[model samples]
Target: MISNIMTMVRKELIDAARDKRSVMAGLYYAIGTPLMMCGMFMLLIGQMTSPEDLNIKIENSDNAPDLVKYLSSKGITHGDSQSTNDKGDQLDVKDIRLVISDDYAAQMAKGLSAEITLIADNSNEKLQKSIRRLERNLQTYSAEMGSLRLIARGIDPRVVQPIKVNVEDEATADSKGGVILGVATMTMIYAVFISGMNLAIDTSAGERERNSLALLLSHPVSTRNIVLAKVFSVTVFAMIGLLLTLIMSKISYAFVPWQELGFTVTISTEFILLMLLIGLPIALMAASLQLFVSFMAKSFKEAQSYLTLVLIVPMMLSMAASYNIAPDTLQWLPVSGQQQALIAFIKGREIPMLQLLLSSVTTLIIAIGLTLGMEKSLKSEKIVFGL
Candidate 1:
């Protein structure tokens, strides 16, 4: 029985390998997605990191020469209309303007409040961080000036405060990159579904379309053996694709500027081993699910369409885990559960062993059930003939 199933598995793999469409579908995703993600992270890190110099428009500079000097000391200064950095690169200038009131220095001399207007589009997300930095500096300068005045008057500057608050952050660098790691891990989880999809559909519906399924089913092997063989073949393809994706991710992720985010996704050797360990059952479930769906379709195109809709369930589960939309329940679900575990591992946290075990058990159960259903369905002439 084992020899017969191995023979069937070898044949299915060889046939699938010959199908360029099946091979390329897995290759493209396994190779392309990680590189694409690296490029996106590079762009994102550049945008997120603060530049060495911040340049904005400062109106009525003479009215607040002292204030302008204070801002310059903080690396916030006015810029030329066509400003360039030391490297002659064009500066990323926020369109923020600071307008000093005409009587700004006079108010300070009279021991009264001074006024300045911050002008910028508050709705612009790109400018929000810069604008807030500028506001914080201004507030700090104002508080310093007030404290100096109180000290000169023989009064304690602490008189203005009724409460003192000190905040201590306990977040590790890995914790800061949780969102990015979650997204990265989600892509790896999805490889299981995508890498084997084409082969699964082709082996089932494609076989029927070519009028070969009936002939193959007529052999002496049991339907259960045939189902197992097919599932194993598809799973081999899925695992291969997943491993390729992980390798690509491990290499490509090294180039990303994760330090700017105060954390990194190293794709450690241990994590790779864990992913492969956890990904096996997912690959099996994915293979069975795809084959089961494809076998129900009358033709290759119909199977593709059905699988598209069917694959969404796993994708949604993975997405929920990635975005942390439903962690409580998804921790025990198949794709999402494994995703959360990988994310936890990346964040330098302990593995959720119970959830991982439950999800793995559930995954194997689904694969077995689907394989059995395919076995039963293959025995029905109406289904075998697509009647």
Candidate 2:
């Protein structure tokens, strides 16, 4: 049986390798996704991070000298549209207008409400971080003045600030980058599913349509051997794709400036090996599941449609785990459990052995069950001949 299965596996692998389209499809995803993700992260980090020296137009500087000084201390200095830096480079001056009321300083003497109007295009996405920074600083200065007025009247500032919450972070530096890790893990896991989908359909429904499956089955090999061979071949392809993705991610992620985001994401060699070890069972499950669905379909296009929809289940499971939707329940589920385990491992936390073992066992069981179902279905005339 093992000999027959190995022969069939060799045949399937050779055929898949000959199909240039399927081979390139897997390679593109393995190589392209990590690079694309890195670009997206860089763009987001740039937009979200506030500039070191925010230059905005400051109106009525004489009316509130103290306020101007406070803003300057916070890196919010005054600049016009034509302002240039010392290196002769054009300064990125935001189109923000600060209109201070003429009675600004007088209101401070009487401890009355001072009016300052900030004008700018708040709808602009590029100005969002700068605007928020300005608003935050203005609010801080206002609070300081209010506290000083209360102190003059022999009042305690603590009386107004009844609830002061001090947050003490216990998460390690590695754990703080969980969000980035989660996304990276999700992409890698999905690669296992997507990388072999086309080939799985081609081997099952495509071969059946071309009458090659009937020819292969007419030989002395048992249905069990054929099913096992197909599963092994697809799983091999999936694993190779996953390995490529991990390698690309490990190399490309090093180029990203993670320190600017206040945390680092180092895809260590240990992580790559562990990810490959854990991805094996998932690759098996993905192979068996796709083969089962492909066998159920009448044609290659139908199988493609079915697998596309069916694969969404695993995608959702991985998504839930990535974003931390239901940690308690999903921690016990299959795809999500494995992902959560990987995440915990990357976060420098101890791996949950029990959950990982249970989830892995379940995944293997699912793959075995699907393989058995495919073996049985191959015996039916209607399944083989599409009658």
Candidate 3:
């Protein structure tokens, strides 16, 4: 049986080698992540940071020229929506309107509470940070004026404050941006699924469509051996893709300016080695899963569609793990559990060996279950002969 499986695997590998493009056909983002991901990450970091020149509509600038000048000093300036530049391009204007009270600075001269109304669509997600920034600046200006008033009256401004709060971050630089790294790890783990999908589909449905499956089945071999051979071949191809993904990550990660984003990510040799070792079971499960789905379809295109939808299960699981969502439950799930373990390792935290072992066992069991299913299905005339 072993010899039969090896022979079948050798033939399939040779066929795959003859068509390199189909064999290396990538999953999606991870495959093209060499340089594109770096640029994408740069954009993400920049967008997440607070903008420098905050522009908004000032309704009554004449009422408080002092406050308007203070705001302008902080780069918060009035902007008209219809304003244009030298090249006739529209200016970057926010829809926010800041309306000062019509008291003409009387409240401030009388040492009374001043009123400033900020108007904008609070529901606009893009303006949330900007609005908060404006509110903080206004509070700072109010506090400063109050402090001056207290000094003029021979009182200390600190007398009114009872407690001060300070927070210190204790996370190491390596572990600062864990969520981003988790997604990066997810992309690497997913390499196994997409890398072998084409070959898995071709080996099963493509064989049936070409009338070669029946001929292969007629040979002096058990269905178990055939199924095992297909799984092995696909797993091998998938691992190759995974290894390539790690290499690309190791190469491409250096180009990203992680320090500028207040974090650090290093794709060390140890991480690459560990990722490959961890990805083996995932590759097996992915291979068996893909082959099992492929054998159930009537055509290559139909199998492609089925597997595309089916792969979303693992993707969502990994994404949840990446974002640290529902970790208490996901930490025990199959794909997500293994991913959490990987993320922990990356963060320099001790791996939960027991959970990882249990997750690996469950993953292997799933692989075995799917492999047995493929064996049983390959014996059916409806599947093998397309009846």
Candidate 4:
């Protein structure tokens, strides 16, 4: 049985290699999609880091000279209160303003709140973060001022605040690596499945539609051997596509400005090895699933539709995994389990060896069951008749 499967695998590899269109389709999907996604993400990162200037308005200017000076020192220019027309048409300022009321100190002393309006172009995303930062800084400054006022009354500033707190993180480098690895793993999984779709369909349903599968099955090899060969061929193409995508991702990361993002993305040797170790079995399972679906399909178009559904499973699993849903009873679910295991590895958490073993076994069991079913179908006259 092993020798027969190996022979079939060799035949499938040769046939797949000879098919230029399948090769091209796999290359385009894996390599093209990642590059496009990376470009869009890099553009978003660029927009996030760019400096933003805002326009603001202060209502009462008389009592907030210190606040106004602070805003000016921060390079934020403010607008005058009288700039509004009778129709309430306010002249737009390029930045925010600090308004000080006559009873500002008294209002604060009584624990009453006064409102300050921030007016700026909200359309710019970068400017929004800047506005938020300014607001937080102002809040901190006000707290400090209140503390100084208490000290003047011979009260220790610490007396008013009963507790002080600080945060310490215990995350290791591997765990940090895991966060990034998770996304990459998900992306690679999607790419591999998508890239192999055409090859799997063409090898099975395409051959059936073209009236070629019947002739191939009539060869000396058993129907199971034929199915194994086709699946092996599809897996090889998928693996190649995945490897290309992995290489391209590393190359793209090298060009990205990590320092500006405040985190370095070093694709370590362990990450690459772990990705391969985890990704290989998943790819095999994907290839097997596609081949089974394609074999069950009546025509190339039908296979295409079925393959679309198959491809969606991984993406949906990935989306679910992103919500940090714990591995409960649902985690044992096929694609979901694989997603969780990959995520665990990516997060630099110690992957439960049991989960990995179980996922691999489950995928293989499903693949073997499908292969057996396909083998049975192949022996039928309806399959040979291309019905």
In candidate 2, stretches whose alpha carbon ends up further than 4 angstroms from where it belongs are 44-57, 75-96, 109-111, 119-133, 150-172, 261-263
- The residue-by-residue lDDT of candidate 4 on 220-318, one tens digit each, is 877877877777777777888877777777777676665555555555567666666666776777888898888787888988998887778777776
* Candidate 1 deviation (Cα RMSD): 2.5
TM-score of 1: 0.90
What TM-scores do the predictions have? Answer: 0.90, 0.88, 0.87, 0.74
At residue 379, give the lDDT of candidate 1: 93
lDDT-based ranking, best first?
1, 2, 3, 4
Per-residue error (Å), model 3, residue 26: 2.8
**Scored by Cα lDDT, where does model 4 land?**
0.70
lDDT of model 1 at position 315: 92
Q: lDDT tens digits, residues 114-204, model 2?
A: 8999999989999898899999999989989888988989999889879987999786555556667788899999889978887899999
Q: What's the residue-level lDDT of 372 in candidate 4?
A: 80
Poorest lDDT segment (10 consecutive residues) of candidate 3:
26-35
In candidate 3, position 285 carries an lDDT of: 99
lDDT of 1 by residue, 1-387 (tens): 999999999999998899899999999999999999899878877875755678999998998888899999999999866988889988877799999999988998998998999999999998898999999999989988998999989999899756767888786666656667877988898898999999999999898888888898888988899899999999999999999999999999999988888888898899899999999999999999999999999889999999999999999998899888878999999888888988888887898999999999999999999999999999999779999
Error of 4 at 327 (Å): 3.9
